[model samples]
Target chain A: MSDAKTAIDVNALLQAIPYARFLGITVDQRGNEITTVLHFSQRLIGNPVLPALHGGAIGAFLETTAVAQLAFEFAGAGNGKVVLPKPIGLTIDYLRSGKPVDTYGRAEITKQGRRVATVRAEAWQEDRSRPIAAAHGHFLLQVAEDAAAS
Target chain B: MSDVDFSPEDLMTMKDVLIEHVPHAKAIGLKVEDVKLSEAWLSVAYSEQLIGNPETGVIHGGVITSLLDNACGIAVQLTLPGRMSIATLDLRIDYMKPATPKLDLMAHTHCYKVTKNIAFVRGTAYHTDEKDPIATCVGTFMLAANRAQPLPTTSKAATEAMKILAQKKGGDA
Candidate 1:
């Protein structure tokens, strides 16, 4: 449980979405900066022959990372309830492919507005110096009253 | 409409032709998995070479876009029946989560409708955990008659694939 200003339970949110749980995304720790890990595996198949991971998979990873950043911020708001933010647009730059191992992602809150929030997210394998992909997105925040009444 | 024939191997070769034609796709290792009247599936695996940050171990987003774009094209080919080439008008993807390390993704893409030149498609990517879709994509493709003659081998292969699919369905039924 969180205060009125803080967001809802992070673990609760993660469990709510089956896909998020499958990706191994958890709250980790809640604050301005947040970290989430996606345990990479070879089971994710694209072309059975090449068996290389698909690009769309990377994009989803980036998008989810970005959303999680927003959620972390929301939780930090101390509202005691996590809010679901919708992405209006996202632009990703794919720099490289992921290796056969777990990859980590981090996010920075560039700007937070009344209606929209801007976030920048990056993913890396073992090291932080270089990232496999980088993404920037605009998220529209939804308040509980607006969200629940719907 | 002239009847064109293609075998599975011929279809595989034509896939190479399509990839070679797209310069960006060629650089990224985009490949076609299956092609039919209104459905298709495409895949690419995780690779260290494809990461933007080698130190951090992450894959690029553009690669995913390329896969989705190719899937949309294949979906359009399914509607044309005859020889057809397709172009993407617009594509939007909803990334649900980040990909796992080393795991490849298969985009199970299919065309839902084709009206005139507009072809609509929807697809999702899954690894071992089908419940967690790595990405979801929706796109519109512009269908145009192909100038090149349909490879005889591709036509034949498509027929066979369809037959197999039908048999499997029949057995299940």
Candidate 2:
């Protein structure tokens, strides 16, 4: 769906989501992979002693990235504007404590069906190979026309 | 870590320090409703700032995850014999439904199992009815060996206020 008529600006779509803006998540296209970044902010820290980034923030970043990925990839399939997928479930594994630093995330769409999608996301700070956390999530995909008809 | 002596009062004080020092907790306006031996309850008041979807007005799932994480950590702390730090190792959350907008959400967590270095926790988030929860989580936390520094003692007036509040709540500490 890379045709000119079907192109969609994923960043603009992300910005429309209030929580994505609240978390200060930004998206960039590196070739075909979509990278999501969460800039360091004191307001995102959960453990003051370790000064670690809140796990929830990292999880949210990954989840949002996955949703953005689905929206970007399947932009033209749905009628009208892209319908953002709703999270069905999320499982995050904290591989290490997230240091208080800028974090990056990317999601792999393992499966994309008509009504559901499964995504696996990883987040890292400083080193991409050594992710601080990884998450697997399933989201319910909605077709805009179906949504409007319902 | 060797078990150290601590009173129920000390744990309560630690909870206050935790909620105050954690920047995100403060940003989300989380409050400790109660803490017992191996359990804790936390609440976050409804605020527009926390809304994830402007169209729905429901608070973000991230906020609920943070609340459950904090509550689980607090439960682990309460189970520990002394003040010691803990970090989340893994957390799995199943969103049962969207939380009702404009209602204070509460999370109740319990540390059901503990070993030398690991604690298992389960938590539920709800608004009015506990039976009908908005989300549920199961997580594991790692207990660090180093003892945590005690929270600074409160001022006399603050202590008196805490005591009065405790009494009013029919608590014996």
Candidate 3:
């Protein structure tokens, strides 16, 4: 982790992904960790009877947060530019039902190399200790050549 | 567990009800295409709202995940004896390739196994050619003990149709 934090417009970066906008995902960066938030909405409900948040929605939120965290780290690395990381594979485990409420998520970069990166993410509504779901995935990092050309 | 003798028409009505009740599925424009004893096919039309990368005009991976998840759940429902609530326990998906822009996506899912409380599923999503899939998924769902209420029928005829189809299946078997 870099001790020096770079000035990056996290909102603008998230806005680039249109689906993030649809889900109303927001970011909160304090120290070294970046927290993602998804406010409750009727459109995000999957089981109307339980009024539980859609499993897909939770998966999407975690994936998006992981991608955003990587982009943020890349921007801080030097060039201050963000590139979209392509997801290769994702595995999510649902620990509990996501009650309809404002959900929070955080992603940790387990490994980062020149071409690939691995991220682990978790989401929770009320208590961080009790996560509703957790996801870990591998992504193809944007190489310097592609970043420079773009 | 009692076996459910469901005809083709009865399965179709059940699919319609399931899709209609799942708000997220309805919002994503997911439609059940076909349903059999332990398998199902679902389709999602291309929409601008689902675009993840505006530059390439490709739909988001999340949309594909949602479709696959829902498809697997539907397959699990078909495999069970009667109406029961089910929740996804875990899902793993591998993106083989980016989806074709402006093209609809389809998922074919099968419930491979069912235990007392768990149902396992496998599925594939494709754009046009079934041979070339965009993604593949395997998942597990936990079945609730209580019987779930049937989704509201779109028409009285649909309910009647299901009864007739059930009768036909019972007679044939």
lDDT of each: 0.59, 0.79, 0.82
Q: Give TM-scores for every candidate, taking all chains together and pairing residue i with residue i.
A: 0.51, 0.86, 0.87
Candidate 2, overall lDDT?
0.79
Model 3 residue A69 CA deviation in Å: 1.0
Where is the poorest 10-residue window by lDDT in model 1 chain A? A43-52
Instruction: List residue ranges in candidate 3 displaced over 4 A.
Output: A1-5, A147-150, B1-3, B145-173
Q: How do the residues B1-173 of candidate 2 rate in per-residue lDDT, one tens digit apiece?
A: 32444577776786776566666777778899988778898999998877776676878887888889888888888788766667789889889988898999999999988898999999999997889999999999988823533322355533454354345435532
| lDDT per residue as tens, model 1, B67-141 | 776666666665565555444554666667656667776777788887787777887766655468877777766
Best by DockQ: 3
Ranking by TM-score: 3, 2, 1
Best by TM-score: 3
Q: Ranking by DockQ, best first?
A: 3, 2, 1
lDDT string, candidate 3, B46-129, tens digits: 988888877788888999888999899888888888767788999999999999999999999999899999999999999877
Per-residue lDDT over A30-132 for candidate 1, one digit per residue giving the tens place of the 0 to 100 score: 5445666766543332221112233445555676778777776676552345666766656665555554456677888799998888888888877888787
What is the lDDT ranking, best to worst? 3, 2, 1
